[model samples]
Target: MSTSVGEAVVGVILAGGMASRMGGGDKPLFTLAGRPMLDSVLERLAPQCSRMVLSANGDPARFANYGLPVVADPVTGFVGPLAGILAGMDWAARELPAAELIATVPGDCPFLPRDLVSRLSEARRAQVADIALAASGGRTHNVVGLWPVALRDHLRQAIVAERLRKVALWTSRYRTVSVPWVEGPIDPFLNVNSPGDLEEAERLARMLES
Candidate 1:
């Protein structure tokens, strides 16, 4: 996927989830307001990155309409977002030679902040951190953060050799920083994990578009 954001960061949308609470379907594809939640995610994220890719683990054809290169988790057996992030890192390293960093977000968060990449990148640079994460309402959204493409090999070893599935655990080894975001009419990092969350997102969508 070719992006024109002029920044050397690739966006990774982690879409590979069981979504058991949503009845085992692609939660990102679920309609939020009148469009797919992933549509809203892409709308907010695309302009902040050099390009984007979808990290998923199913039949990729279902996401063909989104026009992103779908990458499956490098480590299988329901490892979690770290695997997806690794796949994204690998993809960025291989496909986007100029990309030095990757900004990752959960697929279900439709209203993620447009300044996410900028804030994370800025904080990472200022703090001289290896990674930077998003925080809101005093809670860190671990998966929504910036990672260095140069650490892809280390991440791979953590996933493959160490069998690490928890994102926080893996990130703890690095000099990570947090960039807090203020919540307003909507929490920019809100995730639609269940039908109830989807309903809330539906309500927030109208407010966002208004």
Candidate 2:
């Protein structure tokens, strides 16, 4: 299942989290290096993907300015990222029929490498994997992945039946491959979860800029 550079891939930002540890505010909209985190994610992913959609569970108006379609979890009630992934798959299936894969990244991960989609796609093709996860510093970053759109039905069934909610659990059921990004100054997949993490990300950004 080889994919060309121009082949359509839908990029999805999972922004629906309750951000319980971040004091219940929107994680994606948090400031990092003087810009919204979602802005950074979109800027990095826009060129890698042919089209983009946001998986968020709040008022769509907040993200409407981005001009990308905003989709909510069909299962509702903040059921975690699996719901967001399912919503993304459904969107790709209908809007971008040519999209064979949906590449996802957490909106809170401001430092995601620009080559994320390409690297994951390469891993998927190399291993003939149904899903590709990103790894850095010997740890798996499951949310950052390229998933075959064909898995939509299975995911939907799982979510609807309350069978599969955890992303790692779902990936374990598939032919999964890991794309290694081991040569960066920091973990390219670094996510900002707490205030301390936000400060750390800021520090890393400064170092990268120098």
Candidate 3:
């Protein structure tokens, strides 16, 4: 399979959440179907990206084996997924200077679409949008998106000056497009936020594997 669409695109798995709903810990690290959930996400996303990084906080040792860089939120005080997205952008700017864009997907989501980066890239190019986000079942997955690296500075300004918190709020200022995916047997953006959700993911894993 052609894993990379272009050398100018990088992937970032947003994993910085406090995971309070799962009782305070790394939700991506939680085991699902006998494997770490993040591993499944990486498997699907890494091939599509020329390079990939993990947007996470705390000790990076837990993810040491993955070999991908773990970037902490540049903005302090747990600013949510948008912070993670910004961190990813900054990392791409610094490490992959040739990269034009960064694609983000929540680490807790193991069933991310295999064509995620390419479809988002195509949608953004076709629409001439500043950003391209994933949507399913009539709901937008703001955390799962394609962001222009050029927007990093502006995003930093909004976060610092306006205290921007919501992804939709900041994205509204730019020309953005949402690529809707069909909810097959299950939503590709399905994420694990709680213990019960993990159980459901495990069940989904079995179904998808078969």
Candidate 4:
């Protein structure tokens, strides 16, 4: 998917998770550096997308202040991030008809690069890939990816009948391309999954400032 400025590239923040590890609180709403974690994620992704949506299972009103549409998993029972991705694809197919691809980023990944969408989109286009994933330190970050909306049916089938919803597994079925973001002082794809991770993110943020 070749995405130019102003083109219809939908950004989906995957927030539909049970943050059991971090004491069961909403991970995205958790504060990092005196700001909601989602705020930093949205700040990085919003500029690169034509429209943005939050995929959360809980009440959408909680995210009303963000002024972005919050989508719940159409298929219930708390299925994984794949459910969120499917929801995003469905939303893009229905609402943003012109959108060719849905770019997904985890809500806890506050350090995602600002050029994430552009880089992934360009990689997908160059490689003629159906899915484009991010990589840091030689590890593929499958959740941070861009998926073609055209594969909506295949995804839905995989989720419904087979109960196979892992992002990496589904992505492997397609012509997937990985875009490398070489390591630096701060790994751009650092995700805060626990309290300790939040603390580390703060330290990294300070390091960036210094």
Candidate 5:
């Protein structure tokens, strides 16, 4: 297993969302530059993580070719990304018992930074915080954060007992830090939410390729 700052780290791609904005169905399956969006994500994240899993529901067969384990939300009713986070923690705890942390990234973001895990680990250590999230262009991407496996129980309590949905709201209750990244022509955190956004991402992809 790969280690981020001497601690084994696992990566989880949050794909459990119902992409109503993009007319539904697997948004990660959508192509970017003739390859699946998940392919881009995997390509960027694979080097940073020892093992990776997809936090997705429904038929796992859809992602069978990727070969990574597909975990459904542990909580029922599509409890949002928090559920995915908790599920990731649970999975890592079970499958990757040696892993000290799990880092999460959105599935639709094809341009996630190469230094994502190391930077977040550095931010978490420097700030002495329980969690560290990515921020770009003065905006924090709550879902794009590093979570400790030890906090899994508390997260479950927050999601189950308190009905927590908003990621920022839940993260607010913890010691969280945001690691900022320099913005260039394209933001590493740029994600595809709509068809227009996908087209824009395609343009950015071409620019990146060139």
Candidate 6:
């Protein structure tokens, strides 16, 4: 197994969302401050993860240029982010045997905090929790959290056999903890779901890079 917090974790970019609100296209491919939003997610996370995978569905060829393994949700239909996360877990087991945990973030969340994995790891370890999640402005970013690969089977059962869909409901079964980040000039976990959200993200991006 990998030794360190960041190195021990595999990053899962949850790009499987159906961007119906953003006019029905891949939100990750949408331009944000002159580049694809996925680029921004990668820039912040690549260094902090031992390996990274894109959790998306329908035509993996669309993301071939990124050179990352793109895994689709094993479940049929767009169940939810939980299925995408499960796909990442299954991928890590087969491809990255050393990865003990997987950290996740929405693909459209271009401003993901640089310290995301480190902080989540620390929180999980310190609290002896099964899962560690990111919270900003008093709200937890459910998809943006660290999950154990050992629980992939249990998670699969939760989704497949139990029909568990909500992240909160699934996480509540464990000793889940949330690490808070101060949201200020820019909410580091901001995501783009609509055109207006994307426009706002442009301004946040300028502020972040400035």
Report lDDT (CA) for all predictions: 0.89, 0.86, 0.89, 0.88, 0.92, 0.90
What value does the lDDT take at residue 149 in candidate 5?
A: 94
Model 6 per-residue lDDT tens digits across residues 1-210: 232463568899999888999779899999999989899999889888888899999999999899999999998877899999899999999998988899999999888888888899999989999999999998998999999999999999999998999999999999999999998788898888788998899887787678
Give the poorly placed runs of model 1, Cα more than 4 Å off. 1-6
Ranking of predictions according to lDDT: 5, 6, 1, 3, 4, 2
- Which structure among the candidates has the greatest lDDT? 5
User: Residue by residue across 83-132, what tens digits does model 2's lDDT show?
Assistant: 89999999999998999899999999887888788888887888988999
TM-score quality measure for candidate 4: 0.96
Superposition TM-score, candidate 1 onto the true structure: 0.96
lDDT of 6: 0.90
TM-scores, one per candidate: 0.96, 0.95, 0.96, 0.96, 0.97, 0.96
| TM-score, model 6 to reference | 0.96
Question: Model 4 residue 99 lDDT?
Answer: 94
RMSD of 3: 1.3
Q: On residues 1-210, what C-alpha lDDT tens digit does candidate 4 reach at each position?
A: 234544689999999878888888679999888889999998888888889999998778888889998999978688899999999999999999999889999999999888888888888889998899999998999889999899989999999989996788888789999999977888999988887898999999788778
**lDDT winner between candidates 2 and 3:** 3
Report the lDDT tens digits of candidate 3 across residue range 147-186.
Answer: 9999998999988888989989999999999999999999
Candidate 5, residues 162-195, lDDT tens digits: the string is 9989999988998999999997889999989999
Model 3 TM-score (2 dp): 0.96
Q: Which regions of candidate 6 are displaced past 4 Å?
A: 1-7
Error of 2 at 65 (Å): 2.2
lDDT of 1: 0.89
The collision pairs in model 1 are none
